[model samples]
Target chain A: MWETVLSALMDPVNALFLVGGVAGGIVVGALPGLTATMALALMLPFTFSMSPEPALIMLGGIYIGAIYGGSISAILINTPGTPSSIATTFDGYPMTRQGKPEQALVTAAFSSGIGGVLGGLTLLFLSPALADLALQFGPPEFFWVAIFGLTIIATLSAGSLLKGMIGGCLGLMLSTVGIAPIGGESRFTFGFSPLQGGLDLVVMLIGLFCIPEVLAMVDRKRVAKQGLALKREKGVAGGVIKKLVRQPLLLLRSSIVGIITGIIPGAGGNIASLLSYDLAVRFDKKHKDYGKGRMEGVVASEASNNAEVGGSLVPLLSLGIPGAAPAAVLMGALLIQGITPGPDLYTRYPDLVYTFIIAFIIANFVMFVMAFYGARYVARMIDLPADVLLPMIVMLTVIGSFAIRNSYLDVCMMLGFGIAGYFLKKVGFEPGPIVLGIILGPIAETGLAQSMLLGQAEGGVWQIFFTRPITLVLIVLSLISLLSAVYIQTSRAGWKAGRRDAETCDAD
Target chain B: MRRRLNREIGVSLFFLGIAVIAFIQVEGLNRMSAVFPRTLAVILLVLSGILLVQSLVRPPEKKKGETPLASSRILPFLLILVLYAVLIAGLGFLIATILFAGVGTWYLCDRNKIRAIIGSILLGILFYALFRFVFLVPFPGI
Candidate 1:
């Protein structure tokens, strides 16, 4: 293992890919409206030719870099480069306003690197044990896990529970448009040959995530004319390191929060960082200074979000289930390479797993170095005009969709989904749950069919669900996730209503 | 609020329609193949019904007067995307991309005809180089 790691590090080609992936990732991450998942989706077709190890290494680099890179724009323009960095904008932008942008940038970089490394270490050590646990999962348990993932994600993503579930159902329906998983029958092709193949997950992902973003760019073109450029003090980040040293526990706790959140199938970086920020504020003695340019807020948000990169990969590496959306895309990329991720991944290919882990750790260091030196140049990606940027993104998405199977049918599918996604997004339905549905639909179907067959052989169909301890645990977790999502969403809505009432009373 | 409720109700109806269609499709399939999708369709139908009822009970507050796709400018942009997709395979990727980017930039970004044309061509070449040359994607035309 050490020899392979050494060879990977020594291999000039591997080094180039690592650096190139991080650089590309940072550019994508620093650009507003571009996400880590979209970056991976765009890059997936290209990775098709490469071997699995280098392919994963490059993807891993992008994942880590993109997550950390989001902080750059969050600190500079108050707009998070990615959704995960949304919390960073709270304190980061304020620091920039105070002419302490360097401080915020440094803290974010340091924390992201630290958090990412810690998370990567967690993946390295913990994935094997998790894979061992996953081996106990039978077909019924697998079905339950998929259901738990789909329901929780769908229920949690949208502002309204109904809309989220609708999105999930819509995705499941889309996945069912091709052939039946169990029985050899065409389902919903409507007499089109392309429909027989079904909607490609990559095509759907690009269309759902990238196309609407392009349309949004056009829609907001007039409003998005403003450019953000900030001045930086090069050596100022040194002081942030000293300050961060004093609060080791906060960083550790935030990374742990990120890791745990990442392990949960649907919980992602945005949730991880926000939860970490809330914990930081709740536990801090200087809570009042939290939203007001405090360094701790920057640290907690950046650390947790960066850490989420590693955390999210844990499930993808162990079980076939993706821990987050980006990881889902990564899983798709793996599947494209004919590398199905499951418990067998760790056992069947320990070298690939170990090498990828090492590459992930190395990518963090590369991101740290690049972010430290290249912040000024990479941050300029914000100034690229929407007209140019949007069209360029459109070009890539169109071509990328076609490249999936060299099929124009996929391109049309992408455009159709993109338009639908744009409208769906406006109506309060999130695309996240929909993506989850598409990814998990086949898994659930196969498991359900196989479990039913097993059940018939044993006793009864209904007994399979209740007899398994794992299934029961999954059901309980699903219930908790659904209930908590409801509680949080309703409370937020109520609070908004209360504020509106207060304002109305004051006006009266 | 009424507008939002209308949208939600419409969306719910759409889902319900899809559920009905899916249920019908599942009817002819074997039990192994039919069970999962049928179950999903029923779940979707129930969920859609719940959504419709909720929207009727409590409509959300509206902040904007217009819907997202209501802008007069949006239809042309969308039409251009569809036209581009329809034309790309016949026109070749490079030509299609250049045309799409050029026209899209002219309409969506800058009206300067020369700048839009030149900039679009440059972007087209750049993308071609990256995907075709660097990434080796063989995007149907160099």
Candidate 2:
């Protein structure tokens, strides 16, 4: 593969796509209201002229670059450029307000690069093994997987587990509005034909994530504002670089989370980032500082999301199942080229596949080099006035949502979701669980219904779902997650009470 | 009852209402299609019940907190956004965007009328160029 690949790699057009794809991806990703999915969709037309290898490589580059690019807006403006970057805004925006935007961006770049490389390496070396692992998953297993993801709500909501659960239920219910995965029946349409397609994830994402923040910014008073000026530090973000380099465990842990999440079809970086962020909070002594300008928060999210880029490819290459939204677009690109991707693809086009994988790894390097230096200039978005930034963001979001399916209904849905999300956030509901629930609802429902049918043939539903080896393991993991969340919440309450008693004793 | 009310109780009741609505909607669907949504609706009811019980047993102690955003200032802007979305259907993308951007900026921009005017017009053109020419997004009136 490498022998024939050297000449293909040397091709000028491939080189341009590799570099330009990443750069263009980053720019699109950095803008508010834009996402990597939109970037890839727009780039689809350009791929018709190119050969299969270059087309796949260009889409791969864009996929990598755009996912990473989302962090820039997430950090500086409190808007995630993509759904995966939702966790990035948790700490990234706070760091920006605290005058450490430069450090946050640098941390994101390094962690994302490491995660991307690790994911790429996994694709290069472990795809065959991982793809085979993916085959073990059926509807029942996927149901457990979605349930396992939902358990993250326990730890995901540091405020109130009850509210998180309720929010998750709301998202799950929203997901059921469209056609049933197996029954071929529509439940919630109430005679409206447009809704038979259900709610678009991108529409909900824009509404629930971006809309609330813009409204809050409009309502917020200047007295509540922190350090408004962007900080310019010395070389390589000065001390922040050393601090990040020291936390190799955090990088590796977060990347592994991304990689694993990516391997599972339907589970994307959005879940990975949230899961790793939960893990970081669960393990750290200063877990309380997580949503409040923690560098570890940005690193955890960016690393995991980027690593997921690599992880998402595993399923696509192996089974033809797309692991994430962008990966779904890449699958379309492959099909358009008349190249069907699956197990047969490995034996059929070894050189083309191998070269593209190698090129994907190199694209991550280019992303780091470009994003690291380019971040400072990008961070200058802070210098733009709220008046200018505010309306512009809304405009971009309108265009972004509209571009998805060229429909006004999506734009309306976005506004509706944003308004609902704003009120929901005020009442202790975090978007992570709700979004997770939405993402998992389809998978969970499809799995449950299909497994029930399988169970009828195999003897019983319990035997089909609970008796399987993989199903049993997932059940245990879900139980552990639930128990851990309860323990953490109780312990935190006790700690606060104990400190209050100590203070009272001191006063006496 | 009003005095005992809190965000927890409010949210709980709201979700409980949703669950009830879901139960009503599941009537026409068959066993398979009804099962999942029905299950989710039950879960929502159970969680909301727990929350309601928890709040009733012991309401949270009120603490001084940061000022919440005033809806008076926020609602108008939110309405404007809805208006923007509505106008896109009638007036098309170009006209709707320019009006929304200019008016939204003017409303938020510390009263810099000239800047708002310039920014909105330029933004409209910029968005038009990017989406229409470069991306080839075929939104009506683009």
Candidate 3:
């Protein structure tokens, strides 16, 4: 491991490309309406020319940089450049409003650096052990793991659990639009050649997330606000470092939340950041200051979101199941490099794995150095005029969308989704749930169907799933998640009623 | 605004109608095809039912006074898109993109003629050059 790390550090070309990739990713991510997925997709073609190690190193750099870069826009514009930065905006923008934009930038940078390093360390130590454990999992266990991922729908449901389930079912139904899995029978082609190929995940991702954002931005031409002249505090880095040291537990806990959520397939940085923010609020004694420009909120969110980069790789590297959307794209990169993910990855390519781990550690440190010096300049970007910024974003979104596969179909799909997403937002149905459902739907359906088939093949429908302890545990956990959601809704309703009665009594 | 909501309802119903048609189309297939689409159609039917019920239960709320785009604006945008789609394959990416960007910028930029012209030209040239020279992404030469 030490040798591999040293070798990776010594390679000048690898280091240069890594820095370049991080720079590119930061630019892509700092722009509103341009997501990390789009950045990865756009950069994929460039990777075709490079060797595998440098290519993977660059992609890893981009991944980490993009996740951290989103916080810049979130802090300044109140528009999260990526979904993962949504939690950061809760406190980050308020800090900007309070004329502490510099502090927010520094805090975010510091937390992101710490979180990224912690996540990388976790990946380094935990992955080999997890990979060893993954060897014990059979087809049934894999099916259960997929089912566990799908159960996230229950937690993510917005208005009604039923609607969320219907959305998930719709996604699953769409997944079956092309050829059948087991049998070679055509299902729903209806004579269209394109439909036979089914909807591309990248196209769907761009449409469902990016297009809607672009259309919304166009409709509401948000004028970028000029930066407030902050009173230059003594030692900005010292201040940020002092705060982090004061709240060591908060940083540690948020990073853990990020890593755990990231390791779970289907739940990515967005969910991880939100969950961590909630946990921070719960634990914070002075929670009243949370949304009112509290530095802790920004710290918790930035830390967790960046940490998810390393956490997300766990499942992707170990079980061949991508923990997040970007990881899914990275999985494609790995396959393109002729490296298959599974048990054999660690055994055969230990050097590559170790190199990636070391690159992550180095990338975090590089990110820290860049963000530390560059925060003020990056913050100044918030002042760019709306006319210039809007046009630039629109142009980038168009180019980024088109650059993926060089297909016009993708562009059209993006426009369609943008219009649809705008309406979905107006109606109070969040797009995150739908996007997550679409991603996890296929895995869930195939797993459930295969598990059932295996059961039937074994003479009884319930024997295989019920007899296995792990399968039984996962099924029970899924049931508990559903019941808990229902219970929470009911309790909230009851509490509202009690509060209403008390108010009436006081009025009387 | 009422007309817009009514139009949305009509569109959604049309999609629901397609779902039904698809369900019927797959009725004759073996057990595999029959199961998935039928399930999808049922789900779509239920969603449409919920949408219909929600529409009735709570009338579509309107913002204070912003007028829904007259069918005139809607028709033109749709026409522009459809025409671009038709022209893109035959006319090639460069010309089609230039025309599309020029027209789109002209329409979207609040009728600023100079900005529209310059923005469109710059976008077309910059994107074309970036893709063609820097990235070497092949665009069908027209």
DockQ for all models: 0.64, 0.51, 0.27
Candidates 1 and 3: which is better by lDDT? 1
What fraction of correct interface contacts does each candidate retain?
0.57, 0.68, 0.08
Question: Which candidate tops DockQ?
Answer: 1
Q: Write the per-residue lDDT of candidate 1 for residues B102-132, one digit (tens) a residue.
A: 9888997658798789988999999888888
lDDT of 3 at B38: 69
Candidate 1 clashing pairs, residues 3+ apart or interchain? none
Which TM-score values does chain B get in all models?
Answer: 0.89, 0.86, 0.72
Residue A192, candidate 1: Cα error in Å is 2.4
Clashing pairs in 3: A211-A418, A212-A418
Task: Report the lDDT tens digits of candidate 3 across residue range A1-508.
Answer: 6687678768998999888888777766776666786677556656654677888889989988888888888988898877789889978988988978878988988899889999899888888887887677655666666556555553444345544554555555656666655444566778877666666555555555554555555554443445323344678768778878898899999999999878766567877887798789889999867777999999999999999989988877876767777886677677657787766688889888888888888899888777777655665565544444444444444454555566666666656665565555444344545655555545554555566677788888657766787777767866765665565445435634654674576579
Off by over 4 Å in 3: A1-10, A32-56, A77-81, A89-99, A154-162, A226-234, A266-270, A320-322, A325-354, A383-453, A480-508, B1-22, B30-85, B140-142
TM values, all candidates: 0.94, 0.73, 0.81
Best by lDDT: 1
**Tens digits of lDDT, candidate 2, A1-508:** 6788888888888988899989878876775545676577556645655688788888899999989988988887787877789889888988988977888889999899999999999999888775566567888887887787677554445467777778878889998987898888887888889999988765666566566666766766221222134456678465777898899999999999999878755456777887788788888899878777999999999999999999989867875655665676677578657787666677788788888999999999999998888875654542445677667667766765666677778778877887888778766776556665676688789889999999988888658888889889989977876776677567546645754674576579
Best-fitting candidate, scored by TM-score: 1
